[model samples]
Target: MRKFIILSAFAATLFVSCDDTRKVLHEQYLEYVMHTDSLDVVHDAMTVHHDALKTDTRTLAQKLKDVEETDSIAIADLAKHQVLLKEQATSLSKLKKLIESHADVKSYFMSDSISVEQMEAQLVEMEANNTDIAARLTQIKTELKMIEAEQESLKKTEKH
Candidate 1:
């Protein structure tokens, strides 16, 4: 009958609609997984960089403490610089902790109902921050090496 045909057509349309919806959701889920993986990779790299900076700061501090010429103005300047480096290192540590506390990036995105574009924006921001930190760390390390070389030169002059 005409009624029977119409009813069957309606059922088929609903079924197709449900299938399409599911396909869209599955694609979205895959994209989310990829984003989560990218975030994890970036976070891990940041953590490693942070740890290296902390270690370098500690070593430099120890060397400063061991320097024998406390009265030298150069040594004083180096000590001041070392203090600043320590402060920066402490700030970095706090940042690392904060990031770790929000390690579940996927949950954060889901809980806030953030769109994929927003998540990508955040990821880019994180990458930029990491790059900035890395540049700063490199600069600090170079300064520390120069200071060490100067200290050695001073020691040689004093021996003469």
Candidate 2:
């Protein structure tokens, strides 16, 4: 009887702490995942438009390693990730097409011999793409901040 009572007390203490502690870790992981997602298009749109990025390749590729189910702790922040995933993927495809279309421009830049007309055309294309990419990044960043704040709050509560 005494052993049973001791075990019960121990279990109770463990339950309360573990419940919230787990929530904290889960929330941290969720934000990590969300930020990882927001970076995909942001990075692609900016300084990292390499060949691999043309396909399903970005920093978030790791966070999105598996997505069969979003309810798990691994993907708790699934909805945002899903939306960003599709939008970023679409953006990436469009960006790749834009870049591919400007193959001549890239070659010209590399070759150091381009006509003024070609430069103007490339400039226009870049301006349009830059605007679109900026807008998408703004949206993703806003969503990411919101989720990050929520995760922070959850962590603080868990600490107590």
TM-score on alpha carbons, each prediction:
0.45, 0.37
Stretches of model 2 off by over 4 angstroms after superposition: 1-104, 109-114, 154-160
TM-score of 2: 0.37
Residue lDDT tens for model 2, 1-160 = 9999999999999887765654554444344334444444455644333232323223333434443432345244444444555575566567546544533344453332554445445555555655565576576456545544644543444344
Query: Which has the greatest lDDT?
Result: 1
Residue 88 of model 1 has an lDDT of 56
Clashing pairs in 2: none
Task: Please list the C-alpha lDDT of all candidates, in the order they appear.
Answer: 0.56, 0.49
How well does candidate 2 score on lDDT at residue 20? 61
Model 1 residue 29 CA deviation in Å: 14
